[model samples]
Target: MVLGRQRRQIMKILIAIDSFKGSLSSKEAGEAIKSGILRVIPDAEVLISPLADGGEGTVETLVEALGGSLETVRVKGPLFQEAEAHYGILSDSQYSPKDEKLAVMEMSQASGITLVSPEERNPLKTGSYGVGEMILDAYHKGCRRFLIGIGGSATNDGGIGMLSALGFRFSKENGEEISPIGEGLKDLAGIENASVPEGLLQCSFQIACDVENPLYGENGASLIYGFQKGGNKELLSQMDLWMKHYSELVKEYNPAANPEAPGSGAAGGLGFAFRSFLQGELKSGVSLILEETKLSKKMQGADLVITGEGRLDEQSAMGKAPIGVAKLAKTQGIPVIAFAGTVTEGAKACNQAGIDAYFPILREITTLEDAMNKETAKQNLADTVEQAIRLYRLQHKKQ
Candidate 1:
């Protein structure tokens, strides 16, 4: 494998890869890819740009990319248990006023499915109150603009839990206050928001969402995602009906709440909550992250852009971070290559999404458990990247 003159010419390469869940972080994966590129071309100029798609690593990715600090606070967990949650705050200098701080939050930190045990994965019992706590924590720290990634939720509460944390009240028909949870939605007869934190009204929110499911229906939150949160047939039906009822009640309080709005079903109705209560604007996660990372500026004179995720499959073609990066690079006529932990069926769809080529980072045949081992994944990622770059050079030399 040799590049010779080609290797010297192709000096600038950018790596903006997503985290490999349960394995490497976005920064770690980018470093591994960089190590591989360095192995093939020792002097190649490599830039490591960590990324995420509004999922687990979103807060960290944006913080790292924009040079921010993470603030951790004790917040209510999905099951109403105490848990430590993290939100990122970019320094004032990173924003326009140079004194205004920006907060980046991933809802998963406070109300994600991973917080619950398999045996206790009941959505009816989960609450997004913790997510609200996280936001308030950031607000107290002087963040007025929030970029929230709402994904991987465990609750089916239609934002009432979150609103509750912010001082909103849900009342029973008899004028009794009820704690907001999936099961409590049916008892909510009235909403009181006059007591909500004053700061909340001044803050702006932007939600990163990827789905377009409405608030309640066959494709909605309860029916489509409740089962994953431990809802059975009967429970799902009840949950769906409750969501419909809750959405209507919310509409009475806020006319802007349209349950038929796209992405209203995301994060179990947290998207609906943000959209209706906070007036948050929904945008694709990858597109938001790329703009935050300034990929357009980074791609200006790059010879190649490399990106990857935990897996490359049909899903990768559906607005995932790697494909989003590839499309951005393609617009500038920059070649984009991706490396994934494994290539599964339907990965060919990535070709149509603007990825010039992709490679699987597997050293040898191995079981799923072995392939996911931290050391094994790191080394394989490096080796596959090294070989792929060599092959790319080899192919280019012929042309």
Candidate 2:
């Protein structure tokens, strides 16, 4: 007589996907995958963790994942005009101590190139003062830990604009205060921090930076990025010279300054300023997000792991968010499957990078606009995931 098969244990699945960019958010993508999984296994356990690459959607992804709140403040814009910016505050017990709060922000929200119209975009006239104001606002709200994504800036000021707002004064040879714009860097002769807030000293900063350009030279901020910020050849040359002078001054003031360090030129030298003055640590954006989300811990006991983003290509295999998640899941011997809106031939690299298999969610040929429609993307993602999970169940049943 054939023995009765033993009952199977409930399947546990962990989903951590990045935003679809102009389509679905990270949270929404995870929910869609969860819906698909539930359809396949009614009693399966599913955990959703939203993630970002420390770029555009970082604040929203972190806020949702950590159960945090958002705070908005009006601050100086790239051109020193009043601009509204929003940041996330995390008080979750899992991520922070009861008395400690963490603030997550993107510099683009305040000093981004998008804030300045193309005709008005000029690195010489732009500043990062708004970024500093945002930090101060969060500090006053009891936040001492900062996770800042410094990308898409409009200034080439060597971060003096942000420093000025943070109570660090920059002066010319005559000791007159210098304007906190890129042009001001040309005449800068002195740096003073006597007025810096005491609380700021106790704060710690983690900067999300992926670029490796130094403070000045060919690959520096001004020479490489200034042109995109509306700088002409002549202006970028001048700005690069000013950046060199500013780095020298910073080195003199902070003996430990490393102007040539990787990422020191990120965000028009805001990376240098953060490293030199605020003691911020620059790190890989995707790696930082993975650590903060506690993805490793969450993967524990998970029978399978699912991760993906808007697109899967060679770049995704080269340390993008989805591959980051897959690598971590691999460390624990969990199988990882990924789903994307579109898949390119280069995406085959993802298989070697820890994604056991990947599937494109698009069902039929359609216009980009229709594919990206919110409702349409959601339905497509749910349907694709459901089929994948059904196949997953069939494989398990054979065992």
TM-score of each: 0.87, 0.96
Best by lDDT: 2
Residue 240, model 2: Cα distance from true site in angstroms: 1.3
Give the local distance difference test score of model 1: 0.88
For 243-305, candidate 1 gives per-residue lDDT tens digits of 999898998999879999999999899889898888898999898888766778977888889
Lowest lDDT block of 10, candidate 1: 91-100
TM-score of 1: 0.87
Note the residue pairs that clash in candidate 2. Answer: none
- State the lDDT of candidate 2 residue by residue for 123-142, as single tens digits: 88999999999999999999
